[model samples]
Target: MIQTFAFYLFAVFTIASGAITIMARNPVHSVLWLILAFFNAAGLMVLVGAEFIAMLLVIVYVGAVAVLFLFVVMMLDIDFAELRAGFIKNFPLGMALALVLLAELVLGIGAYRAGALELGVPDGTAMAPVGESNIEAIGALMYGRYLFLFEAAGIILLVAMVGAIVLTHRPRTDVRGQNIAKQIARRPDEATVNVKPEIGKGVSL
Candidate 1:
């Protein structure tokens, strides 16, 4: 079926890109591969009937996060030799982390095979109302039950964005900057110099 073929295509690209992302020597190339992985992963999300998640994967991860990573990687002055040295030194730590992740994956798979864990008693309200679409249900729940939390998250992100802008902003003293007040306050006589210069001489600013 077309759906199966599309799923396989997305899965293959996602896995390949993820592997390349890690193996890439250049940080910028790695970021590019990571973006590719995010795109394919988003495609897979779409095939699985989770269009909302797919949208988030594309808009949030690929559009914002991956582009930010690419820009940061491009701007940074990195030393690959030093990075390799650090990687060698931290190889054991990395392996240990990988083992921990592997174990978590195995446990998760086992748990799923056994059946869904009884983590909580589900309330009937969690289910979408009849005749409502998935996105509509999600929107209703988000705006209805978690409105304050959503607003708080927005406020937090706004503050973080403002903080980043403030941190990166540098005041320049060497160049003349626009003075709106000074320009507005000036009269025509003060603003313009009506000088008759010698024919061969250039006028000074």
Candidate 2:
């Protein structure tokens, strides 16, 4: 009973927050709602015995993705009123698309409940023990089975990083960039000066 109640609680919160994420006028508030949805989704995953997925959802999705969204929304200078005006203009089309998506989801759920779209599981297979470590299993799969895909993802992330750097690169006319050759070849004499004191007053002291 307690487990069912908890499941319902998490489910309700997840759905509500997901809706708020899309419907909120403020981008920052939307990001916050998205984070809340992530948290509840993680809880739901935990309840369903997928603790590894739950951890990933909380640690990776919520900690990194949601936080990145919050930071981006907070830092960017966006005119909410202008965005709202544009949204108002496109409201009918957007509403139609949303309704279509909702109908599809409802149909999908109904089909799933009717056993029309059942997934197959291996015979005699069972879930791993609760105390069994996920990191080992994940590492083995990542390094052994999906090594190529992992490397491809790494390359994609590297390219994205390089692109971000290129986008943010700006040439400043006022400030000069360092010249490595000039710095390496610089003479101490050119950089230093010998000072001579005036004779008369110093001698008296």
State the lDDT of candidate 2 residue by residue for 9-31, as single tens digits: 99999999999988899999999
Q: How accurate is candidate 2 locally (lDDT)?
A: 0.89
Candidate 2 — which pairs collide? Answer: none
TM-scores of the candidates in the order shown: 0.78, 0.71
lDDT of 1 by residue, 1-205 (tens): 9999999999999999999999888889999999999989989988887888888998999899999999988888999999989989999999999999999999998897888654577788778899986788889989989999999999999999999999999999999999999989999999788899899997977
Q: On a 0 to 100 scale, what is the lDDT of residue 95 in model 2?
A: 91
Regions more than 4 Å wrong, model 1: 104-117, 164-170, 173-178, 194-205
> Candidate 2: worst 10 consecutive residues by lDDT?
124-133
